[model samples]
Target: MTPFFASAASFVDPLDEVSAQMHDVTSKPLRDIVVAGERLVAVGDNGLIIYSDDHGQTWLQAAVPVSTDLNAVFFSDPLKGWAVGHGAAILHSTDGGKSWVRQLDGRTLEALFVDYFEHRSGLDTERAQSYLSALLSMTRPGPGQFFMGVWFDKAGTNGYAVGPFGLILGTQDGGKTWQPGNTSIDNDDLLHLTGVRQIEGALYITGERGRVWHLDQSSKRFVMGEVGYDGTLFGITGRDSTLLAYGLRGHVFRSIDAGRSWASVSNDFAAGITAGTAVDGSGLVLVSQAAQVAISRDEGTTFELLDVPRPTLYTGVVSMTGGQLAMVGLNGVTTLQIQ
Candidate 1:
């Protein structure tokens, strides 16, 4: 038997490849979907971004500068948006997801961490050393880093993205530059931050081991909040003061006082919930990894599971025109007309 060895020359960064080539990806796996004004944009593996102006009726692939597997996409406004994915990649699009340009990647992220930690070492040697060690472990090369969630403030001025090993980044000047936000949060164990959402003018983040953090404007830091469940939370969703955090094994908790307290929402499905979205008027929906959809009409007080047409592992969900719902997951994009 002959053994083969891996070499640096054989490795290629996904960001170096262009994603302009297109095929029929309607049946392909898509991770997330968002509505940008009247158009709907969906992103998934291999840096694929497809937009549909006529509601999921037709799709056109966007010009993506990278071929990495994008995990999340967010549009602060109709024309400005960002996408984050594997390799700690961040891509920006100015024209409503028609095209994308790389803003940050694992290499840039590594440099940023090194520079930030080196500067921080002077102020707090012990803390900086610990953080520097963690950062160094992730920067060992390849596509080991992943950004799971991305969100922008309503005004489109401030933006944030989160990922594994407590990686968080903030950008005040849109996507022009990014800064480390790990110091702002109290993540002692370096848990993976899987999801982030802005609720009631405040930002909240969910992560592994039942960790939930709320951004305190006065202190300019993310303060940890109490939650009963200890499973990994994949996504957070709600409107106004009501919020829902869902994750492994279909576990969900509802927060009425902006995450100060959480109460369990009754769920029957056993599949892990991957994403959720709030309806326009007064409702919310959560999607599971097994393609199960749960609808809560009473602001997450209760839920009713709906049978999907196909059983594909879903990753994200979004409300669309006329009370419709569009889900993205293992099978590209699917539309749901809720009655």
Candidate 2:
């Protein structure tokens, strides 16, 4: 969810009541979409989570407990999933995408960070104080906090959610508990962490100023991998050994050796790339905020622009069943077929 200004003393319940009745939200703003088993789950503003089982021809609303806008969602499996968004809220669901329960929120998040920094080990007094101060300023018990991206491992045992000002939270036991993960990363500037993905055998995070980080196995921490452009990177996706990081002003870069190096890839549009995903057998797809679509048939080596039926600000894209694509954004969900 986007930021909303409010008094520091003002308090908004993160678990605000949401309606249970179903409504036609197909044309509402949607931020992210994912495939959970055979169901297509899309989330957006007003705590909306809509699912479709028939290739996005029709949609059904899910039961969400909070009214805050949900920015990102991920399913460890068809049966277990989580959604995070404004007010620093984390919602969990066990039955596909039918219903969700509040797991954590801004109030709890503030406490968690304060405790972590106050009791953290191996930090110099000045550095620990600096970290604690930053966390206190960022997690100020309010509703403006936002989570931009989320990803889970194959076995659903580990997961991560990242967002504004280098906010990173990790869960080792299926989101039952979350711990601050920013201490391990090398984000001194505290830039906004936009996306997280587990590709190949490691986890990669993209953030502001073209910063990319990979989880170091030996150190058990996230280390800076490489920098390609000076602009912000919105998202990253990979297929096999090839990876793509895309962001501000149509910038896109590819790395084949797991973030060791990168090469700039030419893009047709000047608008920023907001989302990307790997197709099962067709290659990679990247969508921009200008509603432009690009297809890379050679594992992101090269891309060609594709025509969009209805141009709108696209926030997320996912490859669907039968070589189809489902996109969600300001104008809601749209399905595209590629040959």
Candidate 3:
């Protein structure tokens, strides 16, 4: 005979959650969403690049020049952009995301160290000397993290990429050259960085475990910010002067005072939230792992579920411009719009 267990979980409708039950998308991981030149581009796992031309009416797969999983992409214009990912996979595109050119790859660093080690071994010094030489040569740098997010500072030149192991890489010459930024965090498994927004002349990075960090240009240091939730923070968006963050266990934190401190907001769902976006300039929408889409009109105080076509396990949500959305995962890509 099979064993049975009882639970206290309740079903909330997506539509009736606000009044009453509940419900909840992408191609790859579809980690980041951005709008450029009337086009909406979403980048994700396995070098997946997709875009919508006519205000997200439909989406088509865009060709990527690299093979590595593109964790992040940013376009200042429809004509020019850059995408970065693991294993030194940094690509540049002049024709949007249709095609890309390999710029800087991390594999080159490995090859560089290989050559350095082979040459140094001929010296035949003491064991201490050999060990020290190998250590120095292996210190590969420049976007060293498993890059998760990329952003431009309201210009085509200055840019930043943050990812695993608290790595921060900045470029001034349009990513032709990159330099390291001050990352003091000691954690090594900092997986995803969702958004790097400019608030009050400072850049803030939001990511896993409610990890938020701020960059001070004047002092040239990265100061960690307070993210009250211990759960993973996968997305962050700025509306007006408020910075909203969402993550595991329906985690929602808002900072009305420019990300200095955060306050927890009540939410209906108890499962992890995957993505959140501002809808119609008045309401916020969230896609959670419970295979449901929840909408909150009053700044996440409550939620309403939507009837979606598939479960969250089957798709990932990528929010687009004009409140349109796209989901990609197991069965390719699907588009969603509020009629």
Candidate 4:
């Protein structure tokens, strides 16, 4: 039996060692950040998983159950949570990220290929060869190939995942069983998906290219919703009565009337706003890809850079209990005690 808790040093690495440790660019920036009670979890390339019990002040690496790159994590409770990434890998932690078990190996794609070859669906040799080659290529290796965005439903029993090649998977029975869904969007990468919040009795998923899809609450069928812009929509966050969707190169869209209409806020950042998070009734914190952290208290109007000793890429920020701020990102995780 292995242990759940490990030292922070195991996950923390220097700039150069990061690439080799993760078998790729370690400094690619930790993308997904979520808080489960006092526990903070962040996932990134090559199965990197880190958790902090005392806010984001100190982080310890968890025994990753898989070697695939994980992109996003969502927790409905402190103990029950799910993480998703490349190769369709999905991990669940019943003990609040202290320990994680690979629920979905993300290798199912590979197994599907093996079965396809073994059964030999009776196709021409050339066509079969082409199919096999494409499958292999899809599973080859790298970021963006396998899985991307992962979200848990409000009930947390089910969640959706998306990635390259229009991949979409849904899980029921609390990550025990996942069902594949048809993402009518063709030839485009669905970077991220946001779950629905009750606003006028509708739920919507906002993804790449400002693509917004609505799920019928009663039927649970995804119907194409209105799309505002065509760009690499990166992150989506909802607060109060409005929804905020952002994308690459600073494209920000805001909607107060659900997904019906939107207004452009700003697509500009102070050079490296790789990821951001909006705190309810507070402000937004944008973390630069270059390890710079900035805070905008004026409702995404302006930003003030924070001073930190060890230059670290601030991936995302969230408000914690006792008015503290938690920041997570590449190679470094730190928390500011709100004075």
Lowest lDDT sum, 10 consecutive residues, model 2, at: 1-10
Per-residue C-alpha lDDT of model 3 across residues 195-268, encoded as one tens digit per residue = 55554465777777687777756675556676876667766755556667777887878887777888887767
Kindly list the per-residue Cα lDDT of model 4 for residues 1-339, writing each as its tens digit.
444455544564221122123322323456577888778888876667777776666666776766566767878777788887665677888888867777665445555454554454366667656655654565342232466666675577877766654456666788786654432223223334433223234555555556766676666676655446776555555555556665555666667766677777753354434456665445666666666665556655455766655567565666777656666676645666533
lDDT of 2 by residue, 162-215 (tens): 989878889888888888887889987778899887777778999988889999
- The CA lDDT of each predicted structure is 0.85, 0.86, 0.61, 0.60
- TM-score leader: 1
Report the C-alpha displacement of residue 75, candidate 1, in angstroms: 0.6
Candidate 1: regions farther than 4 A off: 1-11, 120-122, 138-142
Better of 2 and 4 by lDDT: 2
In terms of lDDT, the poorest run of 10 residues in model 4 is 13-22
Error of 2 at 200 (Å): 2.6
Q: Stretches of candidate 2 above 4 Å error? A: 1-14, 19-22, 120-127, 138-141
lDDT of 1: 0.85
Prediction-by-prediction clash tally: 0, 0, 21, 6
lDDT of 4: 0.60
Q: How well does candidate 3 score on lDDT at residue 191? A: 35
> What local lDDT does model 2 show for residue 148?
88
